[model samples]
Target chain A: MKILFLGFGNVARRLAAIVTDEGWPSRRGTFPVEVVGLFTASRGSLAGAVDLARARAELEATGRFDARHPLRTDMTPLEASRNLDYDVLVELSPLAIEARGEPAVSHIASALARGRHVVTANKGPVAFAYRKLAALAETQGVRFLFESSVMDGAPLFNMARVALRGCRVEAFAGILNGTTNAILCHMERGGSLEEGIAAAQAAGIAEADPSHDVDGWDGAAKTAALANVLMEADVTPFDVERRGIGSVSVGEVRRALAAGRRLKLVCRACRREGAIQTSVAVEEVAADDPFSLVDAYGAILRIETDLMHPLVLTQEGPEVMDTAYGVLNDLMEIAGTAERKGEEP
Target chain B: MKILFLGFGNVARRLAAIVTDEGWPSRRGTFPVEVVGLFTASRGSLAGAVDLARARAELEATGRFDARHPLRTDMTPLEASRNLDYDVLVELSPLAIEARGEPAVSHIASALARGRHVVTANKGPVAFAYRKLAALAETQGVRFLFESSVMDGAPLFNMARVALRGCRVEAFAGILNGTTNAILCHMERGGSLEEGIAAAQAAGIAEADPSHDVDGWDGAAKTAALANVLMEADVTPFDVERRGIGSVSVGEVRRALAAGRRLKLVCRACRREGAIQTSVAVEEVAADDPFSLVDAYGAILRIETDLMHPLVLTQEGPEVMDTAYGVLNDLMEIAGTAERKGEEP
Candidate 1:
């Protein structure tokens, strides 16, 4: 099986390295998977342009790669489809829902239409058009997996759909975004709300504008994915009632701390009166509670079930690198299963 | 697919109830699994004597049952084998390793030899004779799933084997036994060691003797399971260094608390120089750390991998009921795949 990766972003770079290091093609039981080519963003360079010739020479010296295929980054979706003879596509690009129309989405749609399996760390397409893309995947008889879209490298999607199977999921809630959680933790530590936000930006944990992370749009998109795909709930972005952390005040933060509580931005999706309701809000959690100790970029999910007790799963830290690894992990599962089923691979 | 439960312990009772309540038999998308009969340890009054009779009654009222072959709790394994007809054998009997002369192990072996698929929550057979039983399962082309054996209801086996595929696991450490953790947590909360033990007994959380839990034998068994299955490290029960929380003192717990740390009984398995080492010890964890917040009966696994960072997966509240549910969850996954493969329903 030959694989093509679109965009040399953090996720793509990490995945490519893992693929090579794991010896995908030569692993004892592997089904001959090979990373054929990589395409970066039009503005970026291949493998960060660390001298492809030099890199290839080094890999050859180490007896790792016999040959390296360098593809131009500026190819259109149609161009990529016609030129690439790969069995699977790894889509990792900057998430853009409105303005740029997200190259990852178009690339994924094109790959699926071409009857190639598509694995992605990109949440844009899944959150915006899950049903459509899923149907397309079925029609093409390929797999479309996005485990990293919700909790970075954590198996949030798999846990909900597979691990917690047969149990009636009464509700699902979590501290989904790390940036907002980091800011909340800072404020609870006596830092002013503005100071916390500035600290997050300084640490490169938050974007300059930070609208998506701070305004809860990023988390809303994730919650939508969790609801529709994981829980099989029919819901959309517009259905959610989002309240970002931008409105939280320093006084309120201090007051919460004084009362032995910490302010946490929580996202929840649950069935209420036979309708799925999604909400993002800032709530004060007791200092002794598990949510109170969630550090910078840490995520936790509380799945209330019809059983005697609820199931709580958590993951710490917010490294896009892990999120990238999560995407690769999902691909491996789908690819392995597909190969076992005597598919194209 | 008819299932005959071999025991009426906590796990068996819970699983029977869940299978019935879910309308499992009528769920056509997956396997054609159905609960046909149940056998308890006691005779005559066994069905009525069971604590959760309401759950049993509810299942009987809705779920299809073979009236001509009403569940019998008194029959010997050999008698049941000759008289009853079941496609699957679910063993939830109390674990008895030393009593190898007893029927459980032989019954399991007989079930496998008869081409009956086995799903067990018992650890005795697997922990004692993993190689023999695993070989038997493979020879018979039947699934021998024991997700509940290691960490109660957590997806430890599935996560280590399936979720973390292709990743080089360096080490794993966990709080494996909930009963021991609950006792330690109680002791940390100003109770004497003896008092905590009493509290556990009163709460029905600990066994009468409690040696298995307090002496670290229980965690040792679980650690063995993790090392052998998850890390693919060949290690035996005798190879592990076992140390429980029985020796912890109030002064030590107080000092650890003063140092902003908490004491926890930790089970660790690591590969060192191509050799596997397993141990159970007491460790001091920082208050703000994830393990510190793990309350009574909660279990946590910190899996160190060669990836960007370590991944920690935890299941809160160690309850047999939850563990039973986890086992049922595994059965569902296996049954689903088996059905898809056109195996015997």
Candidate 2:
């Protein structure tokens, strides 16, 4: 499969390295994936089939990918997505949630319009334009999969879509943001809020700005996206009652710990009175709740379904590889090369 | 699709009801499932295209289904599975761990040899002969899906197969048995061991014998089945290092609770030195472990992968509906009527 990458960020670079690394044992053996195009905001864009391994290595060694390096082109991601020959588009651009899923949404929309399959790690497009882009993908008989958007590709949407058959997702409550949760974990350990944020940044888990991680926007976006896709609700981040970890203090964390509870930024979406009500709030969860057990860099989601009363799922280490695997997982599904029965390799 | 049912037990009866009940909202709309046959050890047998709705109602009311009933027939389930015109077989017989997955194994083997797809709630066939049956089904282009075996269809195998694509399973530890867990939960609540057993029986969660659950055979069988399917181990129940909840004392439970811990029957499987090692043992888990949060009639599975550190999953209410939905979920995947993009009902 010929692939086009919209952004050469950490996640996309890892994906390319994994796909090109012969040492990396793939579930689907030696799947034919070639990097045909790459476009980044600051880094120059390139088109035409290129050595993805070299591209990944160059980007990793340096900080940016130049169009003049080996694979030369002067096309933007949108232009490459329009004119380039590729089977699927990997959109890993940084989130632009403030603009209501701008350039990312437009890039994905253009790719879908041209009858191309899209795999994304950008939550912006899905957070705002899930219904529209999903409908467009269906009309075109192509998949628009973003398994990384919600829980860094820990099978959140796929679990709902494939496994929860014949059951409706009545409600869901989850700790969606890992960086903020890590910071909270630090704060719970008597560390100041600044120390927590700084620790996360030093570990390369949080962005430099850290506003999205400190504010409620990231969690709210995930909640809105989950609500729209799984809960069948047409909603956006603006619809969520948002709260962030910014208000949490060491004193409050210590108090909650003394009461055998943990304060967590939880994103909940439930159907009430026949409408989906969503919120991202800081709640004091009991010691027995799964959230209390979620450690730093870990996330847990509890889903209430019609058949199964409640299902809780937790994953640790929302690293760049998780997001990279999401793109590969979605690509396998789109390529119809998903693992089959009786094939253990 | 014409479906032949072997055994009219709680899980099978619930499956038939959910499939035939017009009022039951299905993820796949009005799925084309025709009951071609049903055979029970004591409830009798039927053949030919049966009115599944009326069949379900009769079984629910009478607790037995006779050939002379409304859906009259003369053929047994095995004979129907071999000779009748059917596309799929639903196996829901009682567990026969001591017999090493008896009659169920033969029944499923016969159906698979006949090129019929099989969906089973019975753990026997999978526990004993997963590689053999899976190979046969693959060679015949038929699916032998037994989602209900491990976690009563909480997506254990499906999650690993369908979602965790590029990663490899290094180890997994989980509380797989529900009835024994329920009994342990009762014991933790100051109930006597006998009372806990009695409560589980009264709730229909445990069999009248209750030995399979409390004796550790059930968890061992599940561990063996999961090891066979997921970890690719050719082992059986007898091979697992087994310990039962019957050995757990109420005083010990209280002590663990006082220490912020919970006693749980944990089934662990790990690939050590290129070989899969499995055990089902009672362990005292910390309050922070997800297993500590798993209530009576609830389950928690923690999977350690090479990519993701550990993925923890918990589910509550292991009722008849969960097992029934497992059959339906497998059937959907087999019939390829699974949810498509923008085609949700």
Candidate 3:
């Protein structure tokens, strides 16, 4: 199989490493695949699989590409995506929550328009236009899979979509944003929010500008995406009743901890009567609840369904590796579908 | 689709209710299917889909059949299985751990021989004869799925088999037996082991004879089944380095609780030096650990794999409804496979 990557960030690079180290997963088994093209907004583009660590380092240090690399290209992602010979298009672009899934949506749509399968880790397309993009994929005879959008590599969406065939997902509550949780935990330990952000940023767990996470936009976007896909809410991130941890004080966190409860910015989506309701706000979780126990870097999702009982899926200390796993798993799903129909990988 | 149930018990009745209330899952959509047959050891057999409430009541009250029942028969499951025309076999037979998955294994083999798909909740076939039974199903071009055999309806195995296709499961540690966890929790709460068994039995979570659970055989069986399928351990429950909570003392439980730890009967299976090692033993979990917070009736499984992060799956207060979902989901999987191949369901 040949592939084109939209953004060559940490996630895309991690996936590239997995395919090179562990090989690509397909219906038959794992095997090597060609990484035909790689694109990035910061570092220009590459035409073939080549060592990218030095390129990323030089771009970070010099704020520009080395310009001497043999595979360097001036071609845009759109140009490579349309002209490249590849069976799958991997979209690992940074999320644009405020833009409401913009260029990423166009990229995925272009790939699906050309009858190519898409495996993405971006939340923009799902939160803003799940139904339309999914319909486009179906119309073009391909798949649009995003397992890393919510909780990286957790497979919560796959559980609802594939393994849970007969059951109907009635509702969900999750601690979706790790940055906010880390901020809260830091405050509980008598530190300020800035200190928490700095700590997380140093650990590579939070971005330099964490306005989206601190303002609950990231959690709201994930909530909208999950609700739109699983509950068919047909809603966007702005539709959710949202709040952030900016209003939560250190005294409040310490008091909640003293009372054997933890303050969490909980993202919840449920059906009330016939309409779907989404919310992201700070809530006090009891000591015994599973959500109260997850660390700052951990995530937990509780799903209430019809036939199956309420299931709680948790992943603690998840890093970039987990997000890359989601991309690879989605690719494997597409390949498995094709192989079932006797198509070449 | 037509189904033949090998053992008509609470689980089978629960599935019947799900199909009747929520409808059967298929490639097309939710639709009703025929429950062509129901076979039981003590209550005799029924030839068609009959209201079984009165029959089950009668069997429990008087332990005999009312000759006036229209669909009543003395036909053995084997006899009915041989002569019946059905697309799938729903096996909810009781576990015969000491028998090493007997009668269930033989019955499932017969169904596979007849080229019929099988969905089972019994652990016997998985613990003792997974390879042979799976091979037989493949030879007959059918599926032999046993999701309920391990985690009720949590979908841990499904995550490994269907979703996490490319990644390999490196190891697993779980509180696989709910009864044992319940017992340990009860003992920690200043109750005796006998009181714990009584509480679980009162809640209908434990069998009348709790010997298998207290002896650690149940957890060992689940460990072996999980290791065999996920890690290719190829060993039985007896092969595990096993111990039961029966030897746990009340003083020990209280002391552990006082020390900010909870003693749990943890079932662990890992690949050590290219060989799978399975063990079930009592371990102390710190207060900060997620396992320390689960209630007596709750279950927690932490799976370690390559690519994907460590996944922790937990289910609390699961009832017969969840197990029924497992069987239905497996049925839907078979139907999905058939639908992909354009075969008549």
DockQ of 2: 0.63
Please provide, for model 2 over A21-48, each residue's C-alpha lDDT reduced to its tens digit, 9 standing for 90 to 100. 7766445434677788888788677777
User: Which of the two candidates, 2 or 3, achieves a greater lDDT against the reference?
Assistant: 3
Query: How high is the lDDT of residue B291 in model 3?
Result: 86
Compared with the true structure, the alpha-carbon lDDT of candidate 3 equals 0.84
Q: Which stretches of candidate 2 lie over 4 Å from their true place?
A: A66-68, A337-345, B24-26, B337-345
* Candidate 2 lDDT over residue span B216-237, tens digit each: 9989888889889877799988
Itemize residue pairs with steric clashes in candidate 2.
none
- In model 1, which residue pairs have backbone atoms overlapping below 3 Å? A178-A297, B152-B323, B153-B323, B297-B318
Report the number of clashing residue pairs per model.
4, 0, 0
Pick by lDDT: 1 or 2, better one: 2
**Every candidate's lDDT:** 0.71, 0.83, 0.84
TM-score comparison, 1 vs 2, better candidate: 2
In terms of TM-score, which candidate is stronger, 2 or 3? 2
* Best-matching candidate per lDDT: 3
TM-score of chain A of each: 0.85, 0.94, 0.93
lDDT of 1 by residue, A1-345 (tens): 677766555566566555556466553234554665556544322322233334344443553322343532445545665567888787776567464225666678888988888888877777777887889999998888887777787776655556666666778888888888888878778787678779989987777878888888878777777788756776656567899999898789889989988889888988889888889889989866788877888888877775425656677675877787687777777767776687756
Instruction: Put the candidates in DockQ order, highest first.
Output: 2, 3, 1
